[model samples]
Target: MARTSIDYEDVYQALPGMVALLTPDLVFADVNEAYVRGTGRPRESLIGRYVFDVFPESVNAPDAKNSHHLRASLLRVLATGERDTMPLQRYDIESPEHSGDWQEHYWSPVNCPVLGPDGRIRLILHRVEEVTEFVRARGLGGDTAGRVLEAELYTRARELQELNTRLREAHAREREVALVLQKAMLPATRQMGHRRAAVRYRPAVGALNVCGDWYDLVDLVGGHRIGVSVGDVVGHGLEAAGVMGQLRSALSATSRVADGPGQALNVLGRYANVVDGAESATVVTTFIDFDRHVITYSSAGHPPPVLLHRDGRVEFLDRATDPPLDARPEPRPRPEASVAFSPGATLVLYTDGLIERRREDIDVGLRRLADSLSHHRELDPEPLADTVLRELLPPGGATDDTALVVVRL
Candidate 1:
């Protein structure tokens, strides 16, 4: 019996497909023999050069978008750590023997990211399959029927690319409108008398930068009291965002006139029954009375808030838990609870995205949050909020929206 020694470099060079490795900055790191042969470029000359600098766009073809498409695909791979398959492109390459002469080429290109051990993108793998011969054959007049079919195919692909571009532009415009509406709906954090507070809101990564999560800090009627709340509508995107705005506004307005957190949420629950897309939404609200040194809280099927004492004790305010908004057939009074806290204690209110993870028990996430809070208990409100997010969220970011409010009492 014998074992064969394998040279990976040899395998890479011998690959049948044209392949090249690029640094995150788009500088060529290495290229396979197939790539070198396909591009008609020497290995020594191509390596370590910027991709675009070596293969500049054809100056004669002013209407061509080959470089723009390739650059955009590569940059998207870097940004999203995902593969991008570009539409068939006509890229004119300079003739090897004739200086300043360009030869028309068509290619199907794909760009993929190579991740490092720590989950960061380290390199981009650029692969291209040349379709120049097929494309040119389609234009030959002798085979009129084939020429017509191939021309139709090319036209369809180009039309599809244009349609995709327009769709992306439309999505961008919608996202902008949603973000403006969301910001207008959510209020800025107001001063909490002698207490310090920090708030953070992060939308799901791919949901057009808009989501149903929201957080609010309100100065109650009395100067010494402040109200903090975090909530999540069941869905994501523009419709959910609209529902979130209504619910958040309702809760905010109700908190001002209602007797306590319970009454405010009860009013919100009744309102959610009529609001479209607000069923099964979750929310938690806390009113801190600095004058009385007491905290009254209520929840509508939301995760419990964390109360961290100056001495490093962690407490979950779970006494007032209830079903999500509009969960019951008939309207009922929401439950409320109160807890007394000493000066210098910290109160953390958050949406479920702060703790929930795929396929993992929620208690584990809760314990992890509690441990992180206890370890970083000495930090002030702002840094503590950041630290909590850094410690709890996945490196790639959460799939759901997250809203957090940290208050130092």
Candidate 2:
């Protein structure tokens, strides 16, 4: 009969808690998976390395320091040939990938002397129980395990404060980039031949990300017709802004050759199919023909444009709308509607951010927008745009990118 020898190394590695064996000189002889994960160091890098050298306080700082308390505890275990329970430790480690930023960690450690057959200490059984989460949850370590970890917890609190500061700085930089991108997409106010047009854009105050809302104007070759566009790409951030820029450019180019808003939107549908992640968009494009004194407009799953008449009559330029970009394959032709522009009349083209509310139906928002416009119908173009926003939105304003273009004839 044959007997198989027990694999003691495999057994040691299978321990559930963090466990390690240190040589008499305090060098790592063995370590378990739990210990490797908790330290965030590979077993290969830790083995045969001095404990203090591997986990120094700061690797990139000019003043490199060693763990004096850890060294003292190990020496005590070796000299007395007995177990020693260490107090809560603020063993900060430098993250090489993070440019040597200090990562605060707390641990309850114990060292037991392993004596040889000749009654001399040969190895130390080092075990660590991590208590970082417990300390953070309690907001302080004083109440944790009879107030033993209060002093160390103060250091952890400082680390958290520093982390929050870094995050706020990053958010500020992001907001700046978003503002720049948004400004690049929208141009200054201009006159398209005979018609006067003005644009207004406001970014969400509390939103961390930027939205894709834009307005564009392009004059036709004959100088008698002008194309006006307002669109909203769903979602927020750099990707949305990028798509908004592309669509605005595409609509402008398509308008140069396309007949009217219906044809321009149909061409834009084809462009959306090729753009990655640009699944859906809503738009209202209008062609102002000064020769005929009429405006032709179309909607593609967008809120209709509000038309204010000289006689104080308010009407929405709504027609048989096509789906948003990429919403349906082989969609029917986008229908175009024409309305005669009266003298001193105003047209308001805007994104849904002007009227959309968080918990209310979209129809309610539309009615509110119409009511506001009817109340301020006599105001000039610049003040009219301002009044509509001031009335429809809250005191703090919308939490999404808003683009408003007002045309006064």
Candidate 3:
């Protein structure tokens, strides 16, 4: 075969990919320079070879890829008489550039059947592609790394939610335990006849019963006089409540033995210093003895008592008493004060929580308390306490725990 003028050479050489035209027997009829370059085979060697003979591995490597699968997929399109797109496939070809780097590819084959004068199909047309980049670019862009980090963040958030749920349950149980201990600390009936005194211990805004404020009313002087003391223990929580119980009991026992309100507080202060020791600090308190309308009281370093006159006038009676109970063991050399009750009036004694504020000074808080008392003169003890609790304490909590006592003379 001298030089057969196959004009297809010019068109095939210009093509971008490996190209080939096969004879009816599937032997290479004409192929491009690209095909020779890709397979590293001479044109004469590939010419007379059958298609399968050129790439024998294609048959054995079914899913293990070869151009044969591309040929088969094209046959499928031929049977269906439609166009087809093949997913990315791979092939192993030794190339000077890549060395051992496996070359991944894709192929598109279309049949252009020749009508051999007998109206019958004859030759097939095939195209080949290299789709390495297309396969690797699933989500390929600048933010690809960000997607992985986002998944990790979502997993960590779920773990934190679970931890918070467990922590909340544990905190609720702690509050329950504290309440149980607090209720056990109430004193039994300590008054006379039909009229009795029972403590309605209100909690701080945020806490349950963990406050230092407490009260004691003990029958003394053969039921003729009642020894009443309302005091603050210093801190909050079970620690403060425990200390208050100790001090309250000591005051009740002392009041029974002392002659008057002033004498009872004087002796109680000296004992408190010894029991709690000078190292620990304590707050001021007021003790009152009710000798059938002969109302006398002694004060400490605490907020003063509020006298609500029957005429609706409020007074903060800050009479100086002995220093706070645990401040020192030395008895106050100064005398305690006394006040005869103005009949049909009321006396309100309280701890710091009632009148003390977080931002304002003690004097300012006292003024507010006295003003509030006169403002709500007609309100009963319970409602008045509620009003003051809402107003005096901040929305969340008190800087210090408080206590209050109201006696309508």
Residue 171: error of model 3 in Å? 4.0
lDDT of each: 0.86, 0.79, 0.60
Q: 213-309, model 2: which lDDT tens digit per residue?
A: 8899888766578888898887677777888889989999998999778988888888988887557788889998877888899988888898888
- lDDT leaderboard ranking: 1, 2, 3
Leading candidate by lDDT: 1
Per model, how many backbone clashes are there? 0, 0, 1
TM-score of candidate 2 against the unseen true structure: 0.62
- TM-score of model 1 (CA atoms): 0.66
TM-score of each: 0.66, 0.62, 0.54
Error of 1 at 142 (Å): 21
Better by lDDT, candidate 3 or 1: 1
Residue-level lDDT tens digits of model 3 in 86-126: 43344545554676654433333334544343444454555
Specify the highest-TM-score model's number: 1
Worst 10-residue lDDT window for candidate 1 reads 140-149
